[model samples]
Target: MQVLLDTLAPADAPRVADPRALTDEDLLALYAPPQQTWLRVNMVSTVDGSATGDSGLSGSINNPADGRVFATLRRLADVVVVGAGTAKAEGYSPTDTPIVLVSRKAQVPESLRGAPAGSVLMATCSLSDGIGEARELLGEEHVLTYGSHRVDLPALKAGLAERGWGHILCEGGPHLLRDLVFQGAADELTATTVPRLVAGSYPRITVGAPLDAHLTLRLLLEDEGTLLGRWFV
Candidate 1:
């Protein structure tokens, strides 16, 4: 992908023209793949600051254009990670990339249970909750465990790399994103800010303990009310 750069006045500036148009094919072509291991967090939110609906679904946070960008991001990922709560709430299915679920308590919903053939992976901290059914449904290689109070992120990344997965994408429900950011594991964040406003006390993109270090980002592209920013850790 190509690399494109732009400047936004400031985060507190008033809205001018829609920014989504700047994220055209030309800009997307300029995006460079990260060297070594990489991870990106993707999210969409309303102008009025809501990440989901009253029913807690992100599906209502985007339009067709946003959906297109979301699909493109997914297509570029080697693995997609989400919390089990998100998987259940969003009724997630395994996509072209391998689906990874992070559950400290092994509470993955039955509806979003099975993986597509050999493409699902579950990361848990314990084996007390037998994965017998999940193993049968997704095959043995699909289930994984860290079995520790704190996961070894570097080790997990190495393991994924050994399996030929270097670019990981995180589609979250806040908690998972928080963990990744808190652990200093996320490389970039791609957020789509929609034109409409949905006022509420709903979630924002990153929710967790404040970062000890500042996260610096460059504005990559803006179009039709959407802004894409890239950050380096």
Candidate 2:
């Protein structure tokens, strides 16, 4: 991918990238969190703004370039926070990086459960009777509760940060992203616009309430008609 725009670069030196040589390490330099406790979201959408396809998974809209950035960001993140719905829809599971599954129902899919205690965490509330069962099925450290009525995103994030997981990478399923916005937890967003268009009932990349957020386009790159962009939110 080549750089099309880079507002994050110094004013004196305009940004430029050589598609022939650009690497994931280079992308990491441009996207690494600048602060200790930070949140960055990564997502891909179609030209028609559909965040997913009939299968309710964004993997169908992804490409090689997007895959590289996805892997790189996870490598740099202290923890990966994902909506439980997306985790189930996308067949998410534990990997080398730690993951915090956010859910109110305590309905963590079977796939994400039974992972190493050091690798997975489930954030839910007291109302969900499945919490104890999930903890037993997974592990004790695998569950955490925030609010009785709802998941307190700020407190959830703080608890993670206190555990030395400061740089947060949120892989949204829309509602979780919306919650992050409502709680003012997101700091950056990296989105990839796929070349294809799908005119379907699927919602746009963001389905949250209209709340004005001040953001600047920090970087933009493209390859094979796929637009990769980042913003400071």
Candidate 3:
């Protein structure tokens, strides 16, 4: 890891001489948000602005540096929020961390099935189908229903905050990221730009209606040809 630019660094020096020598704790500190209650998004993209590669998946476009940052962000977060589509596409499974699967539909992904009790949650709307099945699988307390038409992101955040999950990390599949930003719930974005070009019809990090959200870069790091940036929304 090469420290290109960091707003948190001293004015005399804008970059670290040997960021690669930093330990995991150092990395975690570098990416920590200023606020205790924060919504931080992590995403990977290509140089050509495509979010996916030939396989139409983010993993195909990610590198080891991005993976390190991803893991560190997860470690720093109190809860991990992800769209249902991305969870299935990325083959998400249970870990020590709790995961909240957000979906407009009530169907739970196959990979999340049989997960340990209280390890995973389903977040959907009251209008979704299969609500009974979702409640039965994840337990009634684990199934969070907010809006009648869609899962209200703001309400969901409040609910999670009420549960003491102040540090929120969203690993998106695009649509979810867009909604978070559009809803003004995103506090920061940590994006990694892989030094590769994959021109296709793939989506960007955020998809959906056009947004004019502004982001200010707070930290920038590079490893090999990859660029990892942290921006406040």
Candidate 4:
């Protein structure tokens, strides 16, 4: 893999200028063949460093600008993935991209049963749980079952490819991100850090364990209230 840092420099001299003027979308163009295999992990925190609220909601950390950026990223992905716990807590619905929920027990909320026909994929470890609402509502074929232990991510990717899914985007609730990072399944990481801190006992971004060797990231862009960093591992 290759790493690219897209930043504006002074025209007169070979010096760097302001870094907080470029957007993540502008920096993403540096990646060759945007349609190629790519995954984006997104997280939001408050000005005090808190990632979640008392009710365990990430929406508290997100603003209107963040929402727009998220939606745009979702549009670029072929499959949008999240943990089932996150789906239930966030009340997620199928968007433009197909939805994939990672659940060991295949426990899906009845409210999300109507997830935009043909755009839902439930990834579960157990086959005995049955599709339940996903079957009668979203069609039987939309549900996918994987290993009972750790998910065979490579196999899942191959399966998704067979079903015509190439680009995958992972929107996290921390634990899922940690698993992906630990498994070395994440090819690329796009993180937007807002200029705020929310200090609390709640959890922040999870990466399973501390890296033995630091994973280097290129500073892609930094806008007024956000900083976009990219890493290739």
Candidate 5:
């Protein structure tokens, strides 16, 4: 990818190599988390601020450039965190890395029902009716309950850290991203803006009560009109 700006690199240095010429290793080096225990969110949106295309899924909005970065982030993370809604909507399956599904409901999504043992986990609430089902599907040890009514994001992060899964990546579906930011549980955001205009009723990258958080842009890259930005929250 072409480096539009990199705060860590000297301005006098040469610009980035060609985007088309970059390999998977090059992308990994570019997106590697600077800290060991970091929480970063990866999201894609249209120029018109729609998080999804007509299909109403994030996959519909992403391009090949975003796909490279997406895979790189997943490969770099110790655990992949995603909301149950996104997991279901995107037809998520077990990845090489562990996946933690955050849900208000206690039942596991069908897409992840056959996931390998210990490869997937459910972060739900004790109040949810299907806690037993969740526990039965993913062993009791894998089902983490934090809050009474909802999955407490901070506590979930702490719990993951305790398990030595510190390099965290959250693949969001808006509401989960909003909760992470609102609860001060997110460390950074890596957003890819696709060069399209899908002006419909789709939500923004984050959806919830109005938030007023300032983020510092640490890196910016562009490839084929798609802009990838890394912002520290």
Candidate 6:
């Protein structure tokens, strides 16, 4: 990865200024948040501002550099908060790191049926119907419920923090990202711009109801036509 713009130091001397290439370890360390209770969002979008490409997935549009950053971000996170739609669409499997699936209905998709117990969690509303299923498949401690009929984003964050999973990472499926922003739970965002034009009615990074979450640019990187950026929310 190449540093294009960074606000860490003056324009002349960037704090991450490197004469040699950065190793994967160094890169992951640099992406880590300042505090434990930080929430970071990771997303990829095409040049035309669409989140999906011809394959109806971001992977079709994202390049190798984006994949590398994606892996690094996952390593830095304590818990990966994802939506069931994305978990299934992306064919997510259990990893060494825990995965928190946020849903209103608490439905555990079939794709996650093979996941080892306690490796995956379900974050849902109190009135959700799949509590018993989730608790049986994933351990009881892994099934977290907050609001009565709607998933409380803030409460979910707090619950994760209480369990020492403070470094929250959200790999959204649009609507979940919108809810995170609307609930003011997101602390930072990493958006990689793949220089491909996929002009269609595909969703952007954020969807659902409107939100007013503010963000400030922190770092900018480039690899050929791809631009990787990080912003503080």
By lDDT, the better pick of 2 and 5 is 5
Per-model TM-score versus the true fold: 0.80, 0.91, 0.94, 0.77, 0.93, 0.93
Best by TM-score: 3
- lDDT for residue 96 in candidate 6, whole number 0-100: 92
| Candidate 6: 10-residue stretch with minimal lDDT | 13-22
| lDDT tens digits, residue span 1-233, model 6 | 77776675466754454723556875775687878799988999988899998788888888998988999998888999999889989988888999999988787878887688788999998888888887888878889988989999999999899999999899998898888888888888889999888787988999887778778998887888888888987
The predicted structure with the larger lDDT, 2 or 3, is: 3
Q: C-alpha displacement of 124 in model 1, angstroms?
A: 1.4
Evaluate all candidate structures by whole-model CA lDDT and list the values in order.
0.67, 0.83, 0.89, 0.64, 0.89, 0.85
Instruction: Sum up the clashes in candidate 6.
Output: 0
lDDT of 3 by residue, 170-195 (tens): 99979998999998888888999999
Model 4 has a clash total of 10
- The stretch of ten residues in a row with the least summed lDDT in candidate 3 is 13-22
- Residue 189 accuracy (lDDT) in model 6: 84
Q: Candidate order by TM-score, highest to lowest?
A: 3, 5, 6, 2, 1, 4
Q: 92-157, model 4: which lDDT tens digit per residue? A: 866667888877666666656766777777776545365575456657787776675656665566
Query: Which is superior by TM-score, 2 or 6?
Result: 6
Per-residue lDDT for 13-117 in model 1, tens only?
A: 523344433344433443344465777788888887788867778997777656766767776778887888888888887666788777766555676565467
- Residue 179 of model 1 has an lDDT of 77
Measured with C-alpha atoms, the lDDT of residue 218 in candidate 6 is: 82
Candidate 5 Cα outliers beyond 4 Å, as residue runs: 10-21
C-alpha-based local distance difference test score of model 4? 0.64
